[model samples]
Target: MTQRKRMMRVPAFPNNAKLFALAVVLALFLAPAPARADVTKTNVGGTDLQANVQLVEYETSCRTTESDSDLIQGIIMPRNPASVRSVYFYFPGNTSEDAAVHEGGSDPERVCNPNTDGKTQFCKIVNNNQQFAVVTFNRNDAHTNTDNWLDEASDIQCFLREARTKIQAYNMNPSELFVSGHSGGGKQVAWAVANGGVGFSKTIFWDACYGTQCSSTAPRDNAGQMYLYYRAGTDTQADAEKAKQENSLKTKLVETTLRHPAIPNGCFLDPSNNDLCGGRGEEKGELVVGTVEPPFPLGLVFDETQLIIQQPQPRITIPGLQFSDPEELRQLIVREPDGSVYIQIPFLGQYLAAVYQWAVAAAGIIAVLVLIFSGVQWMMPGNVITNILTKAGGERQEESQNKAKKRIAGALIGLVLAVGSYVILYSINPDLVEFKSLRIPYIIPKPLVETDEPVDSIPFSALPAGAPDPALLPTAADVCFPLTRDSLDPRRGISWNWGSHRDGSDSDACEADSDRCHAGIDIYSKFPGQVVAVADGIVKDIRHVSRCADGWGAEGAERPGDGIVIYHRSLGLTFNYAEVDEGTSRVQEGQEVRKGDILGVASYCGMLHFEVYQGEVDRFQTLNWCPPGGIDVTERHQCATQNYPRPDALANPNDVVRRLEGNFCR
Candidate 1:
């Protein structure tokens, strides 16, 4: 159907005009932010990577030490970034410097051979620094295969921490970000997942990942709540190798992850567009959008509004063709880990221009289809048998002249009707949307190839389980939390999930509408503090509580009055008794009281709201945490849907409780 015109008022993009002004400012400050030559930074060759016109590079501080052999060489592609969220450390393919080192690996210069080429193109390809270093170690040919797996897992943690420090997004920020890599990079990343690590929100390892403890590998332990992806070729020669490594890594990572403190989302990608990646023998490129002078947008909304305006790079823009250094380039990859922010700019090349050449070819195909169909209908037009004569116009005459006249008149009428119908339909309907739902295939008049029919399939149980599905997901107990066998105390193991709950006006400065602030810290009465007369005043209110998950906000809100509350006239303090399975408050409401007395069981639903009030007012108001736009505190909670199993269903519930009580991090 023809598209109806939508009368939407074009929004005023005030940000656009302002952004254009900034682009002008950027063009002026296109040089590296450094004076003469400084010793702290590396002498990364000469190119002002952020210049407005072309690819330029500048020197970076590559002065850190690695492996204790020589000073570490770091080069950066600096930019006046809008806001630096991440940094990338790229280890280009095995360095030629590696080849020069002997079995002794005794290169004091940290210089051996250069990369095979001077103009080296780089990509992260691997998920994290851990896997990258592990792969690098194997390249040394000195370490045993056993070290690879463990190195993969732990290195990931190290890499994540180090990358964060270098990025300097915030000096004291403790946000865990992303890791991305390729091939051997893919293999390294897979190993990281298989072996697991302490931190890192998520990782993307493509074309690589190995089986557990291959000759002494970590059986894929300690992984975070990661999203695992595997894409392999079906008919290609390398299919076996790709599938083997993928399955191995998948098996190990999945098994260990499901039972671990955190379970990651594992996805074996569909093979439909199996060749999406630059797999062996596959097409190397495809058509994509190109920008001549792309802007680094800040608060430049991409969805809905397609307005393009030049915006100056807040941190630094790589300019037309180059980055300030390698660090800048690596930092742009998305999935630096899950929850972290990243962006990728398309590479400039002649090959890229070729992808858009199809604009003309497509037009030619439509022209040919239309011409052939029109020619067939021009002759013989309507069927001779379709005409029916009206009494007012004519009658059947056996004469040859009458027959000829009838055919001609009928043809004219039929042609007129068909043409009229096409025009009227065209006016009502126009361009169609890419709605796959309504599309149906037209029947082809070509021969059909025959194939043999197969027998009915057997039951799913008849087939062997190739790889296990992720463990039944944790219920709602908040699995992303890092707890261990030593932390939880059953007497008061489960507490209300604070990260999920929020109130307004915390004594601590916080947004009034956040859900991040904890209402109060909950803990079991492990030491049993003495309870006495709450105060000289009468009790204000008394109520028992239960699981907030199931029976909250109802008359059952205070059942059988398991707990009690106490009011102190002199101190203005109200102490709540909570989670007692059953018991009337021991003291009378108006009775005089003293120091120590038994309160109630420390329970989740059954809990206390203890506050110090002055007269009728509480000074503190609890509020949720509201991070600035685009930055997500919720990002870290990968297993938001994850829940703890029923206490009795846990394999080691008691041990888990200890871990939960004590487990401080993920």
Candidate 2:
């Protein structure tokens, strides 16, 4: 108030206008500075090249809530900026970024030297190229050693866009942008071309396609984008072939006998030199393209004597036992009883069971605490004389006593209900309350033996004395046996007859009137084998059928079992292979399968229920046709109108079984 401090009031403006002015001022102060480039002389390969090194901070789509900025150290080397027609963006692989630039190495006074004094394989190729500007970025700033490209895809796209602009500032306007990466970097290039929303002219994979990278949908999605898939003769060769087959026109597969690490450099160098490049024999570095006459024969045969050097074998350590093969580890983890292993409950079941156990324990503790609280209330002091003198106090005391009694009664009731329910469940079935892991036996599929001779070429002398003539009998051309020849023996394998009740139904009639009539022949095996496809067909449907109490034994009652339905388009027939082992299906719905391809192993009960239909009848559609408990009168009936086994599509599988038996039963 001391003379009002000679107050000078600033002019007031509208709120929106003030906000706009504030935003402008803040933006000016907080906005990122323009990327500064330091030009320096760097020796690459054998030539002295001018390199423009820049540290760029770019806004990335790594987070959705707010803008996030990331920094990358990039080096651009151009022989002639004016003559540049394309820009190659190279994303260095994990840990390889160190080879490009080191800390404190980007100063104007320092020379940008390659890690090996410009003698590295990659440097050799970089110095050879003159028409394109090679821009290499260190992604280690944003993503350290992580190989997943999806995490930094947005950041990469942002950097590329900014890089193009920076290159243009140097008086170079490149029309085409190419991306290439080695190993982990290759994964990045693949993702960028596939889903980065950037228009990359070409992508080069330097043995980068590994694991799911080979199965990437990028080739299919980017049909027009050109891809050069380089494979080092290793695990990735098979995967690379899959990607090339997706789009043969735009994709090329190149194979080299080099190992995974040496592929990037060896691919460009001539294969004739045995020193700098490893000993290049014939077909060492074969370039296979789509136009090549015969596709490059995959699975190259290498001279083991020349290649595989004898080394000291590492001793595998198992806590309690020693195993020569890794497959033996299964014996320790998986619980196998009587040559049968159990199929584990799904993840959801395990999670729910854990939650249920926790809930039960919590409920019991809460009930006990409630009882304790009630006991404390009962122990609280109350004077009889004082209560009687005051009527209101007496009534209050009475209410307190009643509340304690009610709480005690409620706690007791809760405990009884919890314990009684568990007891009842236990009495009904011990497994319901045992809380032990569910052990549903998983039938292991018998291994298929490969042989040079075909089944048709089998000598007649191999057949049993009473066996039918091999030539006269129906061959696998008609239908391959579901089980192997060894699995068709009555003693060692399976045994079944047509029109026999698997549920042990006493009814002699195989008519629809008898609900207990067996719909198909049941092939019972003491030890089951893999179930094979009956004919060449497409898998139409996969089903899960719950076992009825009357069938088999009560042990598997209400348990769901797997079933497969395959439709032979050429034959116009549908084959239903039921009671397959749960979780052991080798074929999927809509997958094409040839005759003798494994469908799955037999069921836990060592049985296969085989059925046939005249046309394309889905197994699921026939579920309602004469279903257990009968069809509802309120709904219209299609195949259930007649009686039990009512579907007219149903065809006796006896004839087919008899023909297959001749081939396998010997």
Best by lDDT: 2
Please provide, for model 2 over 211-247, each residue's C-alpha lDDT reduced to its tens digit, 9 standing for 90 to 100.
6565463332221233434544666666667766543
Q: Judged by TM-score, which candidate is best?
A: 2
Segments of candidate 2 deviating more than 4 angstroms? 1-34, 37-70, 96-124, 141-153, 173-176, 221-233, 257-261, 268-666
TM-score of each: 0.24, 0.34
Residues 397-432, candidate 1, lDDT per residue (tens digit)? 223223443443453344344334445665777332
lDDT at residue 195 of model 2 (Cα atoms): 45
Q: Deviation in angstroms for 344 in model 2?
A: 50
Q: Give each model's clash number.
A: 69, 1
Model 2: ten consecutive residues of lowest lDDT: 292-301
lDDT for model 1, please.
0.28
Q: lDDT of each structure?
A: 0.28, 0.48
